[model samples]
Target chain A: MFLQQIINGLTVGGVYALIALGYTMVYGILELINFAHGEIYMIGAYLGIIFLGIFTTAGLTQYSLPLSLFLTVVLSVLFCSAYGFTVEKLAYKPLRNAPRLNPLISAIGVSIFLQNYVMLTQGATDKVFPHVLPVTTIEFSGITMTSLQIIIIVVSLLLMAGLHLFIMKTRTGKAMRAVAQDKVMASLLGIDIDRIISVTFIIGSGLAAVAGLMVAMYYGLVNYSIGYIAGIKAFTAAVLGGIGSVPGAMIGGFVLGLIESLGAGYLSSEYKDAYAFIVLILILMVKPTGLLGKSEGHKP
Target chain B: MLKLENIHTSYGHIEAVRGTNLEIRKGEIVSLIGSNGAGKSTTLMTISGILRPVKGKVIFEGREIQGLSPHKIVSMGVSQVPEGRRIFPKLTVRENLEMGAYLKGKGQRAKGKGSGVKGQEARGKGEDTSRGDSRIALAEQLDHIFNLFPVLKERQKQLGGTLSGGEQQMLAIGRALMSGPELLLLDEPSLGLAPIIVIKIFKTIRELNAGGLTILLVEQNAKAALRLAHRGYVIESGRVTREGIGKELLDDPAIKRAYLGE
Candidate 1:
């Protein structure tokens, strides 16, 4: 039972890390905590369900698993990218030159708006996600693992690896980093700061959508409320890893996952969320900038 | 090569540049010298497209660039090293230079001509959508900047934020040069630097102008700016008060008393 719970924790935590990356990346660049990002994740799952419904109605279920997953991911990415772009243009861009607090409030407003909008459209009821993958279990050393768990882990890792490479090597990736460092300077040097920022949102929201789809598959159901807890936990992971650090979010997610799992196994299962929060508090108290965050000194 | 015609710019309700006119011809260093708050920086910002003018036009290389975006102005080959050495502090010195050559490389790649490991990628992407070429051009331009500022070559891997003040100024200039612009707009290049570093920077500016780079400089240090410039403009309260040859302005009694601190 303990081993099974560990696997479960790892699977869920992997998805949380994926979602957390978007938050960390956006915050890293703009210093804007996009409260609406989790709702973007929720929307991704909803998009997947909508696509699946359309495909099933069209009788495309006979397609191979790989092709189906590819279609799901492509459609989800397109939807999420468009959604992220719209969110930025409407909610964030207008308030860009305004006071920082204005945009922060706007982000929260967007979050609430998206949540309620989904609730209104989807009737506030939990929608059951159809099983898209085989549920075969593989046992090793008295530990049982589901095929879905393996798929989630592998897919998340691959996506993370791809993201890491893109940030480190690609031209647009470099532009994003340049803008994050200094928007005015980047503009002076001929970088389109606004375009890079939009691309950042696109990448971040796309990742969130992928995480949403994976989580929906893993849990077999989703609701408008799904984004809230998952969003909080993912945010905690981001903070734990260092809010602006990409690799930090990944490490933070795994550590939080393990802590929650072990706490559930050795202590009370009801205390799992509490345990994660307690660890977060401890981490913050010890290092407010986060585990991997550097304290930047401003020149007076 | 560049002209600001009766341009008016403001910050919120406060008018910073009120009907200011300025010009910089090809192969000349034209300095705008004034006291702080006299709209010198505001004028530069307006030309750089960071601040759009409330009224008037900016003609550069015979093209009207008024109301254009900053990035678009850059694409038109007018590069500004803004006030305060706003280097991308988190990026390496090398990466900072690469950004300058973004559009040039993009153009080169669009033409489908270059030789290097990265050139193939650029050629394949083509001119209309060749991010790869722009990247390669940026790398090549970095090498040119490294040669121009050898210290930067030594500290190529160092983060822009970690550079010393003098080094940061050099990096800012070098970053702008990477774009290979026909015209360079410099805003207060000597602010907060030691006398020795300021002299070195001014000397470099003179050398760059002599090498056929048209320059429009804004400076608070009137004496130093006038010494290096061929022509000078004196602005006060957001308008041009006087314009003359650099030596004539330096010798003017009113200019000496007010700006040159006789």
Candidate 2:
């Protein structure tokens, strides 16, 4: 039974990690909590459904499941990248030098704009995702795990490893780190500050889109309003992990997921969502910068 | 060659540099000497395109470049070692130097990129020695910098924040040189350093110029700056109070009283 809870928690945690990465990367660079990022994830789920629906309509899903899923992931990732890129250029770029509150307000405004935009277009009802992924379970002793859970865990780990390598080894990644540290100095060294920012948004949004699609597939439903609650939870995960630390975000997501799942099973099932925040508050009270965050005392 | 005409810059409502004109020729170390907040640093910033002047022109190699961005100005062969050593503290010494060679890496396979960007193309005649000749080229450049400052080679794996102030300043200047800039702007390179370190930095500055680099140096240490520069300008209250050969300014009685502290 404990192992069952672990499996369930890991599936949910993987999705949160994907979304948390977006928050962590953007916050790492801009130091702004991108409230609209949740909406991008929401839109990603919608794109996934739309693309899958298109594949179904064209009879492609009937012939090849792998091809349909491939098309869906690629098209959804590309569209979400565009959305994320545009959000930064239109909403965040103009207010880059403005007072800190201005961008925060802008991000909230973008979040609301996106939520309503999706609601008006997709209607206010929950959309169904085809239950195409097999519900077949693998039994090891008393613990049974779904195929979907294994897929989500594997994919999330792969993406996380890829992101880790890109940041550590690539020249562009080093520039991103440099820009995050000191923008004026980076510019003086001939790094294009704006382009780096745009690329960051693109990568972050693409990751969030994959999470959204996976969650939609696992839950078998997606609503325009799902982003609001999921965003808050993922943000809690990011904060718990040490806001700007990527590995911290991943670990935080898993820990939060376990806490919520175990709390729901052993404690009150009604407070499943509240379990994450309660734990986050407790952890933050002890370590103000979260688990892995270093104090940015030198920031001006 | 570079020239600044009637450059007026302000931080908020307070003007930092007002109607300041200065010029530098190739292979010369021209120093701008002034007390704190007298616009010596401001003039260097305006030239490096960090601060856009409200009024006037920044002519670089016969082209007007007043409104260009800092990165664009850098790609055009002008780079600045900033007032404070703003090295990326979390990055290792090697990574910090790698960032210094960022412009050279950009120019390698993408000469077509800057063409559509208007006047801010890679017009610098400076060498892009760090481009994709594998790690060998970058290693050679790194060796040259390490030869000049051997201590850096010993601490290549150390974080930038762990370095001493003098070491940090050396890293800053070495990073700027990694870009292979034609015109280097040093802003208060001698600020708050020990006399010995200052002498060492000044010696390195002379060595760089002797090897055919042009420099516009801003310094509060008027005595050391004027001694090292070929020409010098004294900016008082955002305007040029005096300008002449370095030795002539060093010998002036008024300069000796106000700045040289003799």
Candidate 3:
């Protein structure tokens, strides 16, 4: 039971981490929470579902599972990135030099606007995700595992690894780091601050979309309101790890996922969300900067 | 060469730099000396593209740069070691230096100027491989800086925020050097430092100038700034009150009484 719970926790944690990366990256550079980010994740899942439905209706099933998944991931990421870019250009960029709280409010406004818009367009009902994935069970040494669980874990790990590499090893990644450290200084060093910020949104939103698609596939359904709870949970994970820390978000996601899974398994499924909240509160009480956050000392 | 003509900058309603004019020839260390709130920093900020002038023409290397973004100005080979030594607190000294070389690295890679295959690209150019390479090159240029301030080489691994104020200043200047800038804009290098440290920093500034780096320095220490600079401009309330050779200004009775405390 413990091992099973661990697996389940890891799967959920992976999804949270993916979504949390977007929030953390955007916040790291802009110092804004980007409340609309969660909705962007929801949009990703809906986009994937729409693409899958189209493919199925068009009778293109001869494509292998891997190929279909690849196509879905590509299309979903592109769509979400564009969505995120437009959000920044239209909503946030105009208020760049405005007061901090102004952007925060605008972000919330965007979030609510996206949520209601999705509801009106897609309808309130949860659309069923087609179970196209093969469900072969693999049993080894009394540990039974489904292909879905394994695939989710593997894909999540791969995506996280890719993100890590991109941030640490690329020029654009370095630029992002530079901007995060000091926007003015970064600009003085010849980094196009606007371009770096745009790229940051794109990357963050792209990862969120992937998480959304995965969550929809694993759960077999997605709804417009899915962003609310999932967004909160992922944000909780982001805060748990460290608000602006990338690795912190990953750690926070897994911890939250583990806590929720174990709480659901041993205590009560009804209190699963309560477990996450409890962890968040406990973490905040102990280490307000999150697990991996650096305490930024005040400069007099 | 850099020139600023009739530059006017404001902070909201209050005009900070009121039609300031200044010029620095190649290979010269020109100092702008003033009392606090005299708009010395504003002039440097305007030149470095941090603050846009409300009215003025800033020409650098024969191109107008008054309205250009800070980063674009940097790409044109102008870099600033800003006030308060704004180094990335979390990043290691090395990482901070790498960011300085961001644009130069791209230019180098685009032109294929250096070694082929065994060059910067071979050094594990990560995400912005080309950009990273330039930054790495920028880091390599630090040997010159380290030669000037050997203490930085000793504490290269330390987080920038952890350094002493003087050490932080050195790191800031060192980081700026990594960018291989043609014109270095320094804002108050002597703001908060011991007299001995101030002397050492000024001496290093002189050495850098001797080595052919053009510098536009804003300083509160009028005596020391004038001593080191080839030429001097006295700015009062954001306008040039006087300008002349450094020694001429230093000997001026009015400058000596008001600024030099003679």
How do the residues A189-258 of candidate 2 rate in per-residue lDDT, one tens digit apiece?
A: 9999999999999999999999999999988899999888889888888998899898888988888788
Query: Looking at the true structure's interface, with contacts defined as alpha carbon pairs within 8 Å between chains A and B, what fraction does model 2 recover?
Result: 0.87
Model 2 global lDDT (CA atoms, 0 to 1): 0.87
Higher-lDDT candidate of 1 and 2: 2
Report per-candidate DockQ. 0.62, 0.78, 0.66
lDDT of 3 by residue, A102-159 (tens): 9999999999999999999999999988777778988776667778778878887888
**Cα misplacement distance, residue A34 of candidate 2 (Å):** 0.5
Q: Write the per-residue lDDT of candidate 1 for residues A8-73, one digit (tens) a residue.
A: 778877888898898899998888889899999999999888887677666676666667667888
Fraction of native Cα contacts reproduced by each candidate: 0.72, 0.87, 0.81
Model 2, B142-246: lDDT tens digits are 877887789999999999989999999999998988776778899999888999999999999987776667889999899999999999999999999899999
Per-residue lDDT of model 1, residues B198-239, tens digit only: 988998887676656788888989998998889999999999
**Highest-lDDT candidate:** 2
Task: Name the runs in model 2 displaced over 4 angstroms.
Answer: B108-136
* RMSD over all Cα atoms, model 2: 4.1
- Chain A only: give the TM-score of model 2: 0.98
Screening candidate 3 with a backbone cut-off below 3 angstroms (N, C-alpha, C), the clashing residue pairs are A169-B126, A169-B127, A170-B126, A170-B127, A170-B128, A171-B127, A171-B128, A241-A248, B105-B134
Global lDDT of model 1: 0.83
